[model samples]
Target: MSIPLAVVAGASGFVGQHVVEALRRQGSEVRTIGRGSVADATWDDPGAIEQVLAGADLLVNLAGRSVSCRYGRRNADEILRSRIGTTAALGRALANVGSPDLLWINASTGTIYRDARDRPMGEVDGDIGSGFSVEVARAWERELWDAPADVRRIALRMTIVLGAGGGAMSPLINLARIGFGGAMGDGGQKVSWVHVDDVVGAILHLHRHPEISGPVNVVAPDVVTNAELMAQVRGSMGRRVGLPEPRWLLEAGARIIRTEAELVLKSRWVAADVLHESGYEFSHPTLASALAEIAGRAPRGLLPVALG
Candidate 1:
């Protein structure tokens, strides 16, 4: 069989970088689309995108403005536009040049679900939430599904991704190091997370199992409350104390840092129902194991140094 060709957009991002590397290691030829000159095709040129996508077996679109900042009017607009515009552009290009065999896995988010402290949200029965973030997620998936049915598509609804160099882990690690990594608010909010490796693994699994399509939750089976999460972070960092931040304090701190408090305050209780039922085992299935692996690979000073 001939080698598979994969075209990845937003290949410069943290998750995209990992996906590109994984694809390359699997011996598949990878092409990228981004504003950067290094990409095979830039998003500005529809013709170039079509050219790069032609004859490609897979297309992974991770293009979006990072949501780590304060969701001001301008930031919110950019976030929505970046995701929807990129997705629509790709959809249009694929409709014009893509083959039926091509698989397009687009990035979605578990934040699309309501702030659920009640139950875990899954692909089948998860209640769609409202607000700016949820609307963004909904619109993002809608764009993917709006694409022609002949082109296979999977909306990978990922939760908070934990990795060594970057991702949601960085801020938390920083918090722990600075003695501020305690429970935020009431600490009842569920933090549904997945290891970065599992994210890549789920992608590969979904690619091989063509039977699975639609919205698939890319989260680990294990979930934890905010208190438990921070406790683990403290444990991982060998910190004996972490100053918990109440809601008011958290909101104030969020304002000071220019980020939305909803990032930590929202109870994101999501379940990897499709991934579990499909028999895709996770490398870092538990919070402890995930943190251990991340801590191992993390920078030297991030964690407490051992003393004799």
Candidate 2:
């Protein structure tokens, strides 16, 4: 028996770093691809990418620009280009040197599903949404599936990932501390979220279960409404008061912050049917549990501060 080789692209991002550490802890040799000097291969050089990918047992591509910006013309174009271009590039590389034994897990978003307050969106029955974000998600997955590689591929349609140190938790914690932790807009939109630990766990689980392929929703089964989410945020931080923001105010604040309100306003009722059916037990299955663990790891005074 020999150690496995895992090649991870975009290894500098928050999630990517965790994935790399997890793989290394499991005794797998890790290679990274990015624009950074730490990367074994840069995206600019297709030859180097192919070389690094060759003979690797696993390939995880988390390459994509952050969508945490206002969707202006320039940012929107780069968002789409970053995702589709990197995915297509990997596809080309894999076509040249891929094998049936290799497994490619590409990053995707659960936002591809329509904003549904009516029902939960599953992989099989979820309705694809419209708009810029949805289009980007669609194109990102399309590029992955259209690849001519002989290897198995899984488009990880992840939802809002919460964790300590980085991710959506920081901003939310800030909002709570500032006394704006109340619900956004109507506060009825369903939020489908997963802990970062579960994201890593699901990836390893998928790698082990070769039978699971195609688009898989990497989210927790428990979904919470916007109001419920905010309430939990306040509780975790020991905040006594939280002022709710209406849609109009949210739009204004979004412009001020250079981020979109859809990030919080949209109803994302996603169901992890595949993970559930496939028996992937989530470590933080509920929003309460997830937030508690995340708050525990956060810096002192950042959470559980003196209530105001």
Candidate 3:
């Protein structure tokens, strides 16, 4: 049998790029269908999106406006609209052209969970947060649940991805390399995160294991607070640093980053029970190991980003 084909909706984004690489590593023929791609059609054009999705063996929908900035009312509206619209459009397309029994992986976020004071929020946790991110996630999932009958679907609720570019660690790494690296806010807020490599791996795992459906939190099995993360990162960068950026300073930094300080400096220790329970093993689940690998320091037990 010939290798099956896969199409990633948001093919050019940070996470989407890694997902593409992962799919290719698994020997799947891949295609891109997003705004900036060389493809002539945007999903917004009538009958455009469905045509692209009709015959694919697998579909990974990661399309969305970037959440990297402070979301005012307008930005938040776009975020929700971009995701919901694409999802609904895809569903309509599948319904029309007769979709195959293929896996449809959609993007959700760990921020949908409750406040971080709860610490290590598990997958089974009933309460979800109600911020702008949460709104985008809830609407995205709703579209998937309401999708046409032929599409087999899974929602990979992602955590903050730590990678060299366009993920959590990039900006922080740049700042740290410049000696501006310090723990933001009180440094007490938990920030559950995963390496971008792991994000790609988790996506491919779900693609292979058809039973892994619904909302699987794609985060490191271990949890780390802001201070601990900062400390480990500083050490990895070879800096003996303890300079703390107060809450107000972080608020100012937020203005420059366009994203709010609360979003970045806030506590959110999300758990990975679903991914773990599904037999997904993490090679870099802890802060030290992840940092070591990212910093070009050789990590012993972990699968390096280069490996992914």
1-308 per-residue lDDT for model 3 (tens digits): 22377878888878888888877887887876777647534785646666666577788888988776667888777888888988887778778877666778888888888677665777787468786677778888998998875767888888888876556676666556667667778877888899988887787677767676788888897677787787787788777785788988888867875777766666787888877877888878787778877788333232312100
The lDDT, on a scale of 0 to 1, for candidate 2 is 0.90
Give the Cα error of residue 213 in candidate 2, in Å. Answer: 0.7
Off by over 4 Å in 1: 1-3, 302-308
Q: After superposition, how far is residue 161 of candidate 2 from its true place, in Å?
A: 0.4
- Which lDDT values do the candidates have, in the order given? 0.90, 0.90, 0.76
Residue pair clashes in candidate 2: none
lDDT of 1 by residue, 1-308 (tens): 33389999999998999999999998999999999999999989999999999999988999999887788889999999999999999999988994789889999999999999999999999999999999999999999998753688999999999998887888888889899989999999999999999999998888888898899998988899999999998898888789999999988878887788899999999999999999999999999999999888778555432111
On the 0 to 100 scale, the lDDT of residue 181 in model 1 is 88
Estimated TM-score per prediction? 0.96, 0.96, 0.89
